[model samples]
Target: MNIIGGIFGIIFGYVLIRYRERIGGMLGDPAWAASIGGIYNVLIIVGIFIFLWSLTTMTGTSDFLFSPIINLFGGNTPPAPSDF
Candidate 1:
């Protein structure tokens, strides 16, 4: 739904923006519409890809990101000094 909505909005907005000159005869002017639509489309695409990539990459391996450092130290984490 997100992708579909984004695409639909982008297409519609692009059409209105790109044809602003022609549409000027009717609507005020859609200059910003084109650039805005382009920007929106780009943002949506980037966001969707990033989200999908992240989902597929959730390796549940907590250590895959940085546990090796803890393991290298033998996993015996020193407790912080007690201020009490």
Candidate 2:
């Protein structure tokens, strides 16, 4: 759980730092970049669900433990990207 949260945080932070300009422009506030960072993590979780739903292979415990737990309760509430 901690590892997953850490990875999510790193990815979110990276997005905010890398695209601060364009994201800031779209949302009319520089802080929106930071906001969108959280959204990116949510999208990753949702995408993982969709991908897993389409497959039959057994997922490793590590993968399931991290992303699933984060999406279910570890991360932010009212998930960003407005898709939680």
TM-score on alpha carbons, each prediction: 0.31, 0.34
Give candidate 1 regions above 4 Å deviation: 28-84
Candidate 1, residues 1-84, lDDT tens digits: the string is 555654555565556545544555555434664665544444455455544434334534435644777779778587789999
Worst 10 residues of 1 by lDDT: 53-62
- State the C-alpha lDDT per candidate: 0.53, 0.51
Q: Give the lowest summed-lDDT range of ten residues in model 2.
A: 50-59
lDDT of 1 at 56: 33
